[model samples]
Target: MILIKYIIRNHIIPFLFACVVLISIFLLQFLMKFADKLIGKGLETIIIVKLIVYNLAWMVVLVVPMAVLVATLMAFGNMSQNNEIAIMKASGISLYKMIIPPLISSILIAILLVYFNNKIYPDANHAARLLMEDITRKKPTLSLVPGVFSQDVSSYAILARDVIQESNELKDVTIYDYSNPPKVNIVTAKEGKIFLVPNQKKLIMDLKVGEIHESDIYRQNVYRRLRFTHHKIAMPADQFTFEQSTPGGPRGDREMGAAQMLAIVDSINKVQSSYQKEFNSKIDQIIDKKFNYKPIDTTSNKYIYVKVEQRLRMLENGFTDVLNRIEYNRKEINRYMVEVHKKYALPVACIVFVLIGAPLGTMTRKGGIGMASGISLVFFVIYWAFLIGGEKLADRDLISPFVGIWSANVFLGIVGILLLIKTAKEKVTLNFEFITKRIPKSWKSSDDEIENN
Candidate 1:
């Protein structure tokens, strides 16, 4: 009972502390990326702060696994440094027994992470994404001072001598459109009434007694025209819903449910199937690209030098094509496999990280929080590198998705087992000095910088 309380204080607390610190650090970095947007949007300071806090929650949820690992290590490492672990061992406690509190703690954190990923993370992500879109939408309601024409979007300019807010009317309005290349046009209206398109986000101006003027700069010419009635200018389809290209947007594969993932895969497969004829036709054009020279039958007469050059060019082209196909095939398989397993693999990383972290901390026997964290970071970097390599292979279909996703976990798990054994036995870990001692005599001296200046 006493030992369990010590675990709670020494291990669990430190782990929670680490989680808080890591979440804050990550949140700051995330906020930094959108600092410009916050300013540009002219959002309320309080609102912006609230959004930051909300967004931080999502980051906290994602990094829970890492925090659990670091916290476990730091707590245990502290105990080891203070001789608490040594005392426990001498008191007939096994390393496995010492790990119990941390193991329980880890399971709790994992449950929270699963809950956060499914519920909180999605809500936070959605809010952040919506905020970004709103900020970037940039709808400016400018009050142009009579004669002063304000440049809105590129090629469109607006001016009003006077504006009536109550009636939503403009007097002495002028529009200059220079969107067309090598030409410019200006329209002047004496009176205009504004109309908002229903359910669409476009504002239409009905102008009366408007004179149109045109100019050609390259030819150094000007043309004048007149119109008595109303003209409708094209506006972006913000008011009305329009279909958008959906490669990966807010509702991308990452955020999708299981059904969505399957639907996307099926859709992509359909596209590939439909384009099968196109790919087959590519084979016929393949030979033409290979040979630089015209067909022998068409040319009839080819010099010996031309024949050699053509043959060499064909060989080079063929070599390039072969290399391209090999590279492309490898990448395609790698990506496909990695993506297929990502949802499952990433969440499970929490458990794997904890397994590796616990043993590593015990082995180091160093309690400094920063030092433990640094060690954890190094391990994470190594794990991340393996993931990146596997992902690259899986994305291109060069490797199976299952292999790509679990490869890092498998490698890290084996490492965890080895480290666990070493730490449980308290083996002298291999470091630089250990390796240095095995080097030739020329690499070291007894009196020269040997544990002293």
Candidate 2:
């Protein structure tokens, strides 16, 4: 009992460390990719933070399995390095027994992850998507350049001859207002100041020494001109404002839970079944018409021929429509089933990684983060490649959803079991020094000299 407790305790720190490092890496990449969309949008800090937090749900799902791999490798590798495995084996404790605790822990983790994927992940994805849409819809802070027209405000165009950035002032400003149809209004001001309201829902322009020219398109003779000392124009600035929206819409595959997706697939199956029956009936009707024989009067041969041709054309059109519907339903089923399987498949990877990591760690006999990370990266890449490829194939109806998503786990699980059996039978240690030996002596000398300097 004490030994099992010690073994499980060793994994805790490494798993946590791996999770933090991997999540940080994912977070940095996300920020770099989305900086352009978030910058200069004048969004509240809380909104941005919420967006990041929501997106972290998916990052956690991906990081946990990899962390399991890293933690397993580090814990076992360290024990092997310290010769604890040798001591334990001499005392009659086999590697298989040592694996029981971590394996059980991994199963519990996998269960929690499955719950997280089905409950929390889908909502987070939906919220993040909506938040991103709101951010992108918001225009940047209004910018007006000297001797250029600015149309940032809806239904209004303003041209400024000179703009003072420090004062937010404009000189020799000409405005074209198109909020009303058939009547055109042009306002020119000698000096103006533009600013957005506190709510950011309206833009107000204060004009001084301006003339308003109003002309009606329907009546050329109706022209009015007014000169004013001071005037103010309020324009809609809703596009510049950021609003938090409630989540309410149809979600895509990635935005739905496994149960929801399975339900959808079930419904699609029912629809597809109906479509198939309809298609088969149409085919039978066409076949019957094609094979049936009918008699016609000799004097009415021309009319009978025309009637037969029309009937054939109508039946052909009906067959085409039915076939198309069936194909569409089939595609929908494949797409939803793929997502349903994926929700469970990724969580199951936690168990698979532990199986693979334990054997590899025992063989390598190295506990350092560098070695563990390198090995983990290679395996993760292969796992992800299989997952992505299988998803694509399944979505296209090339493979079954169960086969597409579970293939990686099956392949890796088998390899892990075999390695575990072999390691139990014989002692094996992998030396990586050969890789260092391959480095050029000149390069090594340079590195040594640099270190010395």
Candidate 3:
């Protein structure tokens, strides 16, 4: 009973502390990439706070496993280092007995983590993405300086002779639309007001006393064009923000909506089928001899044959590549499908991480927290590597999601078994330097070569 209290006191608290630290570091890391997006956007403090908070959910979800891993390692490592683990074993207590308290704690943490990830994190992530998309469209107006050319969004160009900062109003504004022909539609406004769309998805430039110009450059090749201008021209609104599609949408591995992913799959398949049909027709031409490959002029025939063959090969390869992409996307979709079954699968993973962590901590008798940490990190690395490899394979249409997401777990389970066997015999389960030495000479790159890459 005393030992159980000791285990709870020493192990669980440190693990949670470590989780918080890991989350902080992850937020810092996630935010650094988008420094430019946040800066110079003239966003309100509340909006900025909301954006940052929302973004943190993704970072937190990603960091949970790592936090659990490090914390377990550190807690167990401390136990071994302080001789607590040894004392437990010496008192006729088995290694398995020592693991129970920590395992129980880890399971609780996992449950809490899952609740946060599935519920709060999803809502926050969706909100953040939408907020950022709105800021993207809103950037153009914010970047508009009184006397400078500001290219905030890539699609449109706006030139304002003067601007008012207080109301975000523009004076003598000229806007250019380069989307399609009539390639240059120009708008000049005596004054303009930037208003957000009703759903806050788009930015509307409400031009007061504005003239719209349309260019006529192509009239069946009498292209020496004419241009016309209009009074009171209103620009179309920007695209909607990143709202979660209706619930029934297809989702893929990245946890996209199911309906959305299925729709994409259909689109991709259509493209693949189109390419396949085009390739088949070329093959038919060769087999049926409807067009002679034999050219009376040897040069023209050779040119045609070479071009045709190259085109056919390209189309054939493209078709196969598309099929592969579909296969890979299917794997990703499967991973996302796991989300639908999260209540079952995730609880099991939480249980599994504890099992793996306990055995791992016990096997390396020395180096306490240090060894536990190293071991945890190594296993996690292997786990992450398998996940990445599986995703790549799926992307190449070589594997499925069932194989990809679970491959890391499968490999960990094998290692867990091996370690368990060694621990049962009171033998070391791992040698820190063993894997390094086992790497083949041919595969090892020099430090300089690694740096060059």
Candidate 4:
């Protein structure tokens, strides 16, 4: 009981510490990419903060598995370096028994992480995607400078010779309106002011003392010129507003919860099955028609031949349509299946890492941030590389979703088991002497430096 408590204590502290450190590191990297989109947009501070929080969900999902690996390595390494493993083994305690407490803890964590991924993670992803769409669509707060052409207003180009910044007014403005293609309108106004209509996606441009030139491609030889004392042009505006995303619409794979994804995949399978059945039935009908044909006379034979050709062409087109629909549904099913497997696959990684980390740490017999970081980083890179490759292959239907998603876990688990066996038998060792022997003898040692002094 005491031994189990001690093991749990050791694992939990490092697990938490590693989680915080890893999350911070990942979040900083994320901010580097995230900041570029939000800067100079004049967004409210609260909105920016909300976006950051929402994006943290995916970061948490990725960070937890790596943190488990780091924590397990550090904990077991510390025990091995301190000779605790030797004492436990001398008392007839097997290495497998020693792993039980931490293994159980990792399983529990994995289970909790599975819930998080399935329930909470999808909503965060959906929210972030929607917010990003809104942000990209929103126009920047307009700042027009004198003697510069402003194209910020939706699809209209405006050039002002001078501006009254304090009054938000423009003077001697020349505008090119190209909202209608092949028909361009040029307007020269003595002065104008732009106003935004509240709650409506519209911009009102009030112009005073302007002459309008209108031309059309259909009327190449003719042009219309008009002078007006006052003219107003209303245009659709890209409002810088954040509206709540609407619900009950088609969502991407990443935007759906696990149940929703499974339901969608099942639905696609049913649809594709129906398409296949329909295609087979049509083929069977064509064959029966071909075999059952009869002719009453020469004229009848000619009519039958023409009718059969037309029917054959129609069947060909129908078969093509059915095949296309089936293919599309299969692709969608593959996409959704990949995501469904991911929800389970990623959480299960915590348990797999525990398997790998425990034995590798005992073999290394070193406990420090540097050692743990180096080993875990290499292993994680390989794991992530395989995961990404598998996902791509699965998406393209090159491999089954199950095989692609679980390939990393299977490979890593096998390696972990082999290492665990070697470590248990006390065969694996970190032989510093073996490594140092490969170094050139010409390299100066501490003893040689002392002799020189």
Candidate 5:
């Protein structure tokens, strides 16, 4: 009991410390990239804080496994360096037994992480996505600077000579209305005020003492002119207002839970099955149409030929549509499958890291934040690289999601097993000095060859 407690204490402290440090580093990196989007947007403080918190869920998912690796290396390395492991082994405690507590702890952590990935993380992703979309929809505080063209509203551009910020008005405003194609419409207003109707998603400009000039290419020699004491022009504010995406409906793969993803995959499979059935039906219809042509004695060859050609073209188009649908469903399935496997695969990495880190720590026999961090970075990068590569291959349909997602874990697990066995059997540490000694004397460097010459 005491030994187990000691082992856990040693692992947990470093694990907690690494988690905090790594999560902070990752969050800072995320903020650095996304800060530009949020800054100068006039967003509320609560919204900004919520966005940051929502993004942290994914960061936690990535950092936890890395923290596990770091903690294991640091803990075991410390023990080995202090000869604690040697003493434990002398007392009939094997390395395998010594690993039981930390390994079990990592398993628990993995289990919790899996739940977090499936449940909490999806909601965070959804919220973040929605919030980001909302942020993207907001206009940049409607700053219509003097001598600058403002293209905030779609299909129209506004150029102002003087902008009075206090009254939210513009003087000597030239409005170019290009909503109509092949015609250039211009409105010159001595005074203008622009305001947005958020609910209607419309931008309205109230112009005073304005003259409208319009030219049509078709009527090259004619022009239309109109003058108004007060005129209001309304334009669609699609560019200014946030478009809520399919509200209260299903979300993307990353924003869905395991059950939701499974449901989506099942639906996609059904869609593919339906497409196959439709394709088969279309083939049958085409075959029937080809053979069931009327045997009219009075029908000319050209007429019959044109009819058959039209039927064949329709058949070809049907076949193409079916093929495109099938291909689309297949790609969709691959995306969902990759995401589904990723949820569990990433969490399992914590256990795989333990297997590798424990033996490596004992072998390396060095314990320090610097040493642990350096080694963890190398291994984690290799693992992440494999993961990203596998995901890409899976996405491209070159490999199954299972293989793409689990390959890293399987490969590293094998390596960990081999290392565990070697560690148990007391294998000698690799020595670079021995390799240097074994080098042939005749194999000399360029400097040595120059000296000999």
Candidate 6:
């Protein structure tokens, strides 16, 4: 019991460390990729934070399994390096028994992850999507440059000969208002100050020594001009306001839970079954018609041939329609099934990684983050490649969703079991010195420096 406790305890710090590092990396990447969309939008701090937090759900899902792999490698490799494995073997404790605690723990983690994926991940994805849409719909703060026409506002354009950035002042401003149809309104001011309302719902421009020119489009001869010492124009600024919408709407496959997706897939399958039956019946009818043809003595040969051709054409069109519907349903089923399997498949990877990590860790006998990360990176790359490629193939109806999503786990699980069995019976060591030798001296020196730090 003490030994098992100690083994499990060793994994805690490494797993947490791996999770933090991976999540930070993912968060940084997310920020960098979306910086353009978020910057200069004048969004509240909370909105941006909410977006990051919502997106973290998916990052957590991806990071947890990889963290399992890294933690396993580090824990076992440290034990092996310290000769603890040798001591245990001398006392008759097999590697298999030492693995039991971690394996069981991995199963529990997998279960929690499954629940999280089905319950929490979907809503987070949906909320993130809606929030992003709202953010994109929001226009950036109003900007006007000197000697340029600014049309950032709807149905209005303002040209300024000189703009004072510090004072929010414009000189020799010319405004064109197109909010009303069949009427042309132009305002020119000697100087003006422009500012937005506190709620950001309206833009107000105060002009001094300006003239308003109004003319009707249909009546060219009718024109009115008025001179004023001071005037104010209020324009709608709703688009510039950052309004958060409630997250409620139609969701895509990635935004639905496995149970919901499975229900959809089942419904689609029933529809496809109906289509298949209808297609079969149509084929039977066509066959009957083809075999039951009888020549009429009163009908000319040309008319008979034309009738047969028309019937054949109708049958062809019907068959094509039924076949197309079935094909479409099949594709839909594949898409939803892929998502359903994905919900479980990725969570199941925690267990699979444990199987692979334990045996490989013992063989490598290295516990440093650099070594474990490098090894984990290679395996994870291969795993993700299989997963991504499988999803694409499954979506195209080239393969079953089961095969597409679970192939990585199966392949790695088998390899892990084989390695575990072989290592249990004997000893094996993996030589990674050749890989290190290929690294440039500068890179190796930098790695060494980081390790020292």
How does model 6 score by TM-score? 0.80
Which prediction has the highest lDDT against the true structure?
A: 6
User: Using alpha carbons, what is the TM-score of model 4?
Assistant: 0.81
- Tens-place lDDT per residue, model 4, 351-398, is 899989999888888877778998999999989988999999988889
Estimate, for each residue in 283-343, the C-alpha lDDT of model 2 and write its tens digit.
Answer: 8877777634354776666766777788888888988998888878787888888888877
Off by over 4 Å in 5: 139-152, 158-175, 179-247, 281-290, 298-310, 430-453
> What are the per-residue Cα lDDT tens digits for candidate 1 across 1-453?
888888878866776788788887887798788765555333567667656865875577556767767877787777777878779889989777887776776667666666565555555655656555555443233333566786644566878888765465779988888778778788888888655466546656678888888888886755668676776555443522222222334563335443445566566565555445444445555556444455556645556457757666766676566556555544443443354465455556666776677676666677677767888888778777877888776675666778876888788878876777777786443234675688777656654666477
| Cα error, candidate 4, residue 192 (Å) | 12
Tell me how candidate 4 scores on lDDT: 0.83
How far does residue 140 in candidate 4 sit from its true spot (Å)?
3.2
Using all chains and alpha carbons, the TM-scores for the candidates as numbered come to: 0.61, 0.81, 0.60, 0.81, 0.78, 0.80
Clashes of 3: 14
> How accurate locally, in lDDT, is each candidate?
0.65, 0.88, 0.62, 0.83, 0.85, 0.90
Stretches of candidate 6 exceeding 4 Å from the true structure: 140-241, 290-299, 439-453
Question: Tens-digit lDDT track for model 5 on 299-385?
Answer: 567767777888889889989999899988888899999999999998899989999888888887887888789889988988988
Per-candidate clashes, comma-separated: 19, 0, 14, 0, 0, 0
Candidate 1: what lDDT? 0.65
| Number of residue pairs clashing in candidate 6, backbone atoms closer than 3 angstroms, sequence gap of 3 or more or interchain | 0
In model 6, what is the error at residue 315, expressed in angstroms? 2.7
Q: What ordering of candidates by lDDT runs from best to worst?
A: 6, 2, 5, 4, 1, 3
Error of 4 at 174 (Å): 9.9
Q: Model 4: which residue pairs collide? A: none
Model 1 TM-score, 2 decimals: 0.61
